[model samples]
Target: MMTSAKREAAPANGRRLILFGAFDRHNFGDLLLARCAAAGARTDIVFTGLAARDLRKFGGFHTLALADAIAAFGSEDADFVHVGGELLTTTAWEAAVMLQSPSDTARIVALHDRSPDARTAWARSVLGTTRRIPYIVAQDDLPTRWRTHFRAVGGVAFDTLPGAERNEILRALRTATTLSVRDRTTFDALRHAGVDTDLLPDPAAATPALFGATIGQRGQGGEIAALRSRMRSWAAVQLAAEWGDDATLDRVAGSLLATSAASGTGIVLYRAGLAPWHDDLDTLRRLADRLGAQRPVAILESAHVLDIFALLAEACAYVGTSLHGWIVAHAFKVPARCLVRGPADKAARYTDTWCDVPRQWRTPEDGPLFPETISG
Candidate 1:
C-alpha cells in the first residue's frame, strides 16, 4: 500500500523530454531513448516539423509545425531538449537552428545510419542543407568516409566537437553509451566522430528465430523456413536474370500469403522507408488480393526512429531492399535477409552483429556469413 504523499512525490524523478523526428512508425532506438529519458520525468514529445499518424497515439504530446521545432524548446521550457537531427543531411530542414540553445545549453544530436556512398549523387545538395542549420549541437557519427561530408555540410573547415566521444558522452548523458544507427557506414562514421553508434537491426521474425545454436539445434519453422525456401527460388530466378522486376516481388509475396493462409495468422508487411524513393504505401494495396486483408503489408512512408523500430519488431523477419529495414531487423535479433547488390553499409552492420545468419549479399544460395568487410 502506497500513501498519497509518496505517490505525489513520484513525479519528481521523471524529466520532461522533447523528441524530434517523425514518430509515425515504431523505431527501436527512438522508443528506447524516449522511454529512458522519461523514466521519472513527465515527457512532452514535440513532434515538430512532423505530421505522423503513428505519433498521434502518444497522449499529452503537442505536435508543432516544422517552423516551431526550434522555438518549441525555450518557449515550452519543460526540460532539456535533445537535438534529434538527421546527421547524413545537414540541411536545416530537419535541424533546429531557430531553437538554438543558449551558449551553455546542452543538446544531443542524432547521427547518421547510412553508409558513405561518397559516389552518392546527392552529396553537394546535402552539404547545401547543412548551411541552413549553420552549426551542430552534437555531431554524432556515421561511416568514416561520410565524416568529410558532415564537415562539409556545416560549411566549416572541420573543427570537431570537443569531448563528445561515444563511450564517455553517452554515459555522461545518463543514457546508453550506444546510439541507434542504420548500418556499418554510420557506425564507422560515428567511430570517427568519437561517438559509439549501435546498429538498429531489421525487423525480427514474428516467431522464435533462435540462431545461436549449432546447425542441428537451430530452430527452423514458420518464417525461418519461408526465408530458406524463398532464397532457393529467388536464387534460380536471379540466375535466370530476373531480380528487381515487379514480377519477382509478386512471386515472393505469393509464398508469404500461402504461408499466412495455412497458419491462419494475420500477415503483416513493412517497408524500411530509409530510402525515400520506393516506399509508396500503394504498393502494399496492389498486393491486397494475395494478402489477408487490406493491411496485409504496410509500406511505411514516413516514421520517426522509434515508431519504425516498433513496427518492424512485430514482423517475423524482414525481406526488403531497404537498408534501415535490415539494420532494425537484425538489431531486434529478427531475421533480416537482404536482396542487396553487394557489400553495402547496412549489410556490413548486420553481418558484424550476427555472423550465423547468412547475409547472402546478392549471393544466390545462402552460405557461411559474408566475410567481406567495408574498407577504403
Candidate 2:
C-alpha cells in the first residue's frame, strides 16, 4: 500500500507542494493523474500544475514552468512533491523534460507507466534521456526497447513480454527500487527473472469513481438521468476511425444494429478521446446513417468525458474501440465488449490482464461479449 508523506516539520516557507503533470489538455487520462495526486496529498500546500504545453482552450489549473516547479521543492520538505499520471509516454519528451528540471528536494513520483512510443526517431532520443529518471510507479504494458532502456532507471512496475528483450528487462527490473505489476504476466516474468514482484490493480480501475465525482462536481449528475430516460437499454458504441477506414466503421455499426435489433437495446454513439488527430464525430454520423432509424441512436459529439462515463454507467453494455472506453465500462462493472481494432492494440493488451471472459472482438460480427440476454 502507498503511504502518505508524514513530514517531521513544516516547510520554512509556507508554499504548498506543487503536483505537476502533462495536463495541458482536457484528456480524462491526464485528469486521473491530477486526481490521484490530490487523493495522496496531506498538506493544504497542494497546487496542481501542468508541465506540458497547454493545448486546452480554457482550464483553471495553474501552469508551471521548469523553473517555477523547481522552486516549489523545499530541501527538507516531506515527500509532498509528486509528478503523477500518464505523462511518461504520451509525448516522448514529457517524462524527460519534466524530470530534467533540477531539484533534489522533492520526491517525484511517476504514477502510471506507459512505455514511450519508441518506434519514432524522436521517441528514441527521449528514451535515451529517460534513463536519467530515477523511479516510476508504472503500469504493465511497456514496449520491448523502451523496457530495455528503462532497465537502468530501475524502480518500475511492469509486465514482461515474450521476446528477445526479456533478459535485458529482467536484469533491469532485478535492480529496481520497487517492483509491482498489474498483471500475472508481469509477476511471472519478474519471478522467472529471479525478482520478486507484487500484483496490483491498474490505475484505470480506479477512475470510474473519480470520473463520476468529477461529473457531480460539474453539476452533470442530473443530466445522466435525463439522458438515461431517453433510451430503454443504451449500449454506448465508440470506435476510433483514425485506426481503420470507413469500411471498418460500417462493420461495427452493422454489428451494433444487429445487436440492437436482437436485444431491443438503444444505441448511444460517443467519442471518448478529443485529440484532433483522432476525431470520431464524422464516423458517428456515418454510423447513424448506417443504422438508419431501425434503432434509435443518440449522437453525443460534444459530450464531456465524464458525461460519456455517466452515460456508460447507466448503459446496459459498452461496445467500443477506445481502450479507455472499455476500461471505464469494466471499471463501472457495466457489461462491455472491447473491439480490438488491431492485433497490438492497447485495449487488447489491457483486456488480457483483467477480463476472464473473451471480452475482445476482432470483428463486429463477433458480437458483444456480454450480450444483454446473458449478462447479469
RMSD of each: 14.7, 9.9
Estimate the lDDT of model 1: 0.35
Q: What number of clashing residue pairs does each candidate have, in the order they appear?
A: 46, 3
Winner by TM-score: 2
- Candidate 1 lDDT over residue span 247-356, tens digit each: 65566556555544443334444433322222434455454444545223333333343334444444455555544455445555555556554554344445555456
Deviation of model 2 at 136, angstroms = 6.0
Candidate 2 TM-score, true structure as reference: 0.63
User: Residues 1-376, candidate 2, lDDT per residue (tens digit)?
Assistant: 1232112232235434444444444454444445544554455533433243443332224455433444544332322333333222233333433333323212222322233443233433534423222223121322211111111011122332334234444444443334345455544545655666555555556765555666555435455666567766678777665634777766776777777877778888887655433344777788788889888788875445556657777677887766667767778877777776454444565567677775454544454434554231
Candidate 2 regions exceeding 4 Å error are: 1-22, 43-50, 53-67, 74-179, 186-196, 207-226, 276-278, 342-344, 358-376
User: How far is 213's C-alpha from truth in model 1 (Å)?
Assistant: 28
**Candidate 1 segments exceeding 4 Å error:** 1-16, 24-41, 44-47, 50-61, 65-72, 75-86, 90-184, 193-247, 254-267, 270-278, 288-317, 321-334, 338-341, 345-376
lDDT of each: 0.35, 0.50
